[model samples]
Target chain A: MSSELLFAVVGALIFTLGVAGTVLVANLLRRILAFNLMGSGAFLVLVGLAQRGGESDPVPHAMVLTGIVVAVAATALALALLRKQHEMKDSEEELTEIDDG
Target chain B: MSATLAFDLLLSTALVWSAWRTITANRLDQAVVMFIVFGLLMTLAWCRLRAPDIALAEAAIGAGLTGALLLDALGALRKGKTARRRQ
Candidate 1:
């Protein structure tokens, strides 16, 4: 098989794995990781499919570049939200403990 | 198989393996590390696919910056969620 086909198949497998992990995993952090994995898989499929016609397409390559930047930004946003949620939970617990006392 | 095809197959396997490990790792830290490995393998795959521009971007952004963000997030989340998990 050609490298394009090979990588594209691999990309599909990774995307499926990420979907399962995202849906089934309980940990918030794991969910984020799975989401990132899913993004990478999709990007791979994009590039692989574009090049499968035997040309190194620049359009998909540019798209993947922008996608990577957006993915990183989204990841940062999610993590910040997670940290804020964690802090809120902590304060909530402290309040409950004080009320009980 | 030709040498190039053989190399492609190897890199493909490495990509899937690292991604799977990243999902299944018991520790968040281990998962992040595996994810970084997966990113690096992907950069190599981009180069093989003749997208050198993407290869460079994947190395710097996908592998480098994403890995750093993940590690930092893992560290911050470790204290609270980790405390709960250890129980």
Candidate 2:
């Protein structure tokens, strides 16, 4: 098989696995990790497609680069939100405990 | 297979495996570590695909920034352990 074809197959597999993991994982943190994995998988597929076309298509590469930055920014923001939610739960628990006592 | 193809295959496998471990890990800390590995592997994959710009972005934003954010969140969670609500 050609290298490009091989890359396409492997990239497809990675994307499938990533999406499956994202759907199966229950914990919020695990879910976030899965989302990032899925994003990477998609990015890989885009790059592989660019390679398969021969002579390294610059457009796809540039688009994917933009995507990577955006994905990271979104992930960081989401994690911050998760942390805030966790803190809120903690504070609520403490308030309840005091009321019970 | 050509040497370049062989190397690409290896990098692809590493990328997929690390991604799986990142999400499937039982511990949150381990998951974050695996996620960083996954990101680094992705950077390699981008390079193999002849996308140097993507490789750079993946290394900086995907691995560096994202990993730092995850570690910070994990640290905050650890500090608030006693404050967690009983399930």
Which candidate's TM-score is highest?
A: 1
TM-score of each: 0.93, 0.91
Note the DockQ of each predicted structure. Answer: 0.69, 0.73
Report the lDDT tens digits of candidate 2 across residue range B1-87. 488877877876787778777877778899899989888887777777777888888898888999899998888888788446353
Runs off by more than 4 Å, candidate 1: B80-87
Alpha-carbon lDDT, every model: 0.89, 0.79
Q: Write the per-residue lDDT of candidate 1 for residues A1-93, one digit (tens) a residue.
A: 689988989999999999999998888878998999999999889999888977888899999989989998998899899889987887787
Q: Tens-digit lDDT track for model 2 on A18-63?
A: 7888788887877888877777767767767767756788887888
Tell me model 2's lDDT, rounded to 2 decimals.
0.79
The numbered model that scores best in lDDT is 1
Name the 10 consecutive residues with the lowest summed lDDT in model 1 chain A. A89-98
Task: Count the clashes in each prediction.
Answer: 0, 0
C-alpha displacement of B52 in model 2, angstroms? 0.9
